[model samples]
Target chain A: MNCEEISELVYDYLNERLDADCAVSFTVHMDGCAECREQVSDLQHTWTGLADLPQEEPSSELKARFYSMLESQQVAAKPRPLATWFQNLAVFPLIPQGLAAGVLLFAGILIGAQIESGENVDELRREVRSLSQRVTLSLLQQDSVSERLRGVRFSYQSAVYDEEVIIALIDAVGYDKSVNVRLAAIDALKPYLSQQPVLNSMVTFLGKERSPLVQVSLIDALFGTNGGETLETLRVMSNDAQVIDSVREHVRTLLEESV
Target chain B: MNVTDVFSDNELMLRVRDGDNVRLGMLFERHHKKLFNFFLHTAGKRQVAEDLVQEVFVRMLKYKHTYRGESGFGPWMYRMARNVRSDQFRKRGNAPFDSANVETVELADERPAPAELLETDQSIGLLRTALAQLPIEKRELLIMARFELLKQDEIASLLDCSVATVKVRIHRAIKELSRIYHQITCEVRA
Candidate 1:
């Protein structure tokens, strides 16, 4: 096969799907042709590099949502269309619907009063932020991995970087069972890395984080701290036998660049 | 042994089609993450990717009766995923790039420091941006061929093209990807 023909079959050859005779012919061409060999090598390297890009696991909420959806689908699949229709009609009646509408109207009026005159918008926003942080903290403590991922996301969206949120995030990075949630925690902590506590939490987590993805993210986040402390932490991590080789190499590079 | 252990994906899917709804969970466990990654890489958004994964399985359930049990389940699932994604675009009347995570590209650009890993990640990010810049068809083809580990013939089957055509398209897609990746990286370096 000429280079052009080999190029067409290169990926197939690299993927090892070519038939035995074609594969031998391809190999014979590679033996005689340097340019084709280089082309195949470059393609192989690119393919390998693409594979090395970390595999991102979806957050646990996806599984939960899938199961819930499957359950509902199965329920809907059951032969009860007429029964369900009647049940819905019987349940959604006039008097209770009116009562529900009245309650909603009353709540709307109350909310309008609060928005208009109860407090300044900034204060109300502050209250909302605080409430969200509290909820985030509670969610972070939940056993459900998806809930914890949601909590980490909430922390990212939070306007307030309260110590509690930071601590919860730190704990998550250090101890979350799911790598996805911990990775989310690493992302959620990015904005707060400027704060001493957050930086300290990241540095502390660096020592304990076992996942290569989390370690790389933490390394990336802390690489900008611009101090001996960050370098020192990286230096220690670089030499740690437990740290992955790729991470250690990166840390060493960070050390050199920082110097 | 468990039924999942005893059956291939195609076989399991056949069971799923034949009123054995529980077998779908086995398939979900087998392929959902792969599907999620495919959508994540394609869409560049976790939430959207997750939703799309869910949507693919839901479509699989809805369309289970149509499985001919001929092609491998991976290719079939990906075909359904592509349909789900396109159907979404049609329903929303928005282009695929409308929801591209521009913030991620910006985040990658923000880190200007010179560490090997950082540079590596930045390169990956640049590649991602380049992939995003390609027309959606080229990007999807490259993603399935490279990342999803689908064979050329399988992809051709999925795309309804000849295997030879899929090979050249994938090669051209990689060439385009390399060009865009280097162009973006050079701009970043400059």
Candidate 2:
């Protein structure tokens, strides 16, 4: 490349963005180019000097505020998760033995339901409801349960075509090892996301998780939940000159009612 | 002492994650000075830098769950601070900040002041004024490299760009600074 061409590439060359052959060419030119060498020196000096700039620390009061916030967050998250509670139940020999004994009872109930419409799905729903109620009642008797069970806490919000499938889906979302499975759970939960806890789960997936793929889905969930707020947040991010505004603009468009 | 024994910022952060408040405090103590200095130079004022530094820590705490254990913590914090500073100015309005935190820089700060600056008499007050005039991208490139003492590779990682790009940005920024410095100094001394 000529001097003019090399001059135009000074930034690229210095940054090592140039191919090895081009860089060698550029270095060879630099050995004879006084002005270009000076330019390189100036950039080097400024970058070198920046590291020494002094900074101010957050005040002790501010640190306390941060500390307290973290303390509460940890306290909130430290609970043995709901899944852990259920997983422990899965290992109970007495419960499994009871389930074995209930097999006869379920057979009788299944026979009765099969006589009505042969809908095993409906029968399973009825059985799950009774079992959950019995468990809740037993806890209530022991004075250990939180005692805040809703009348239909175990009832489905929507007329799920396959309650069994949805239960499996929700279970997979909660405990499946793959992030993709959890993301699919978020996707499946979309139509039935009127409840706040499920919506909170969607937000937690998007805002708290580091996986960018999951983040994109979370962004989609945020768009569905509250586009205006999501747009405003993205707008705030877009304000940084260094940030890629095109990404922000794309997010902004998702908030628009046009499409 | 080895670099790790001197002050392991990474270890301190891990301790903070494990709920060691004292280690968090130590992390702050070790980094706050250097971070504040970077903020001061970039912000061109002390209280604003101090406030921004505090905001950075608060944000760090709030987003601790989001830290992916990928990059070293300081670089990540700097990236956060960079985003915060940019967002803050935007929130205030897209107005170009005219007056600096000039009145608020630490009196004890021994870094080169305009009055104390040793340079060509023509460009004495130019570097500061010129630096303030660059677009945020250009200014940030120069500030992180110059005042923060980040190596080119470190800056590349912080900015999530190749070192070549960082080099190019810094080069252009310095050239612009040199031009702006000469212009302002001639004006001030006129």
Candidate 3:
């Protein structure tokens, strides 16, 4: 082996880590070479010297300092109120982030009111809607005309689009004493116009209705449907003199417009 | 201490990374002394060694996400310790190979009692002085191989070199340290 190769084997030889064949070769090389042997002897002494250096113990204060530092870090890492709120928000689905902006804006008030209440969110939302529906139903039964009008307006807030609410609104349109409440009922029912029962009720009301404005509103409500039955209803209402001139004129214009 | 047997170091480190700070305490108890001795030998100052040990755990917490559980924790932590040591050198605006003021640092940490100082062997003191004078690369290799007891293969991985290269470097470093120690002992005798 070359001097360079002998030098590489010296560490393993001093540590007694050389493989069997390598150990034999290393001994043969060293037996023939004084310079490499002296080098190995010096390296052995240095390795022993390094091993003799004291294993110093760190000061006791170090442990105290480390625990203190860890404690401070834990305190710093604790989540704050704003971060907790953000974490709660992050739990919501991302699709809602795009389309739920208006829902979020409305729910934001509810969240603020119920923060830390630990109630189920779906349960809370259902509770709010159910309470609104109950209040609408109760107001519909009030003796005061204005209270019943409020009941018609409140029905619009029904999240479920409740059947009782639809029935109550139809009753308002057909039987309520105040024309304004009946008009409000038509406005409330506008959202449910796609329902077959609402359309049928409005068409049935057309023949017996006395108020020109209510008749006009119903005609306009049904005008978009533009069914053959709606056209016939308008035609019949147009000929009735009891219907106000303006109402009759509107129907004639609507009928003419439809054709 | 049995915790070390219960779970592997990587699992403990992963727990620490996953935000179980208590697991860090377990790891610290397991490896702090070895790390302390590494820093002590490298920096040659008890306070600096203690501070570096603290700094390593802090950076581990800060940079936990970077750790992938692919390798053993020892090499990963030693890599971070090297980085922490390098960052300190950068902040101080100095290269590590510059003459270390380690004698003054060692003297400042604690004063041995008069009898204890007299009883101290001259060769051990001379050895430490020789180690301090060796270049940082050679000193670190010797410290890792001789004191830290890391195998040649682990040192090779740590230095990003072949195992053959690590053996050659370690042999050369030991030779240089011997020459330095002899020169110091001669000067003392004179």
Model 2: CAPRI class: incorrect
The worst-scoring run of ten residues by lDDT in candidate 1 chain B lies at: B101-110
Steric clashes per prediction: 0, 15, 0
Best candidate per TM-score, number?
3
> Clashing residue pairs, candidate 1?
none
Rank ordering of all candidates by TM-score, starting from the highest:
3, 1, 2
Residue B103 of model 3: what lDDT? 61
Error of 3 at B184 (Å): 1.0
lDDT string, candidate 1, B50-165, tens digits: 89999998888899999988978878888899888888767878667522544442221245656666667766666667777877788778778777657767898888889889
DockQ preference between candidates 1 and 2, better one: 1
The value of fnat for model 1 is 0.38
Q: C-alpha displacement of A232 in model 3, angstroms?
A: 99
Between candidates 1 and 3, the one scoring higher on TM-score is 3
Against the reference, the lDDT scores of all candidates come to: 0.76, 0.56, 0.77
Mind giving the per-residue lDDT tens digits that candidate 2 earns over A1-259? 5667665676565445688898888888878888877876765444333332333444455445544554465556554544674576567757667776676576667668766885667657855654553343222222222321221223233244333233333443444455655565556666655545454444443433445555556566666666444555545544545434555455556645534
Question: What DockQ do the predictions score, one after another?
Answer: 0.18, 0.12, 0.20
In angstroms, the error of model 3 at A2 is 4.7
Alpha-carbon runs more than 4 Å astray in model 3? A81-259, B1-3, B94-100, B107-120
lDDT of 3 by residue, B90-171 (tens): 8878666324575644633345635545424766777878888888888888988887646677777778899989988888
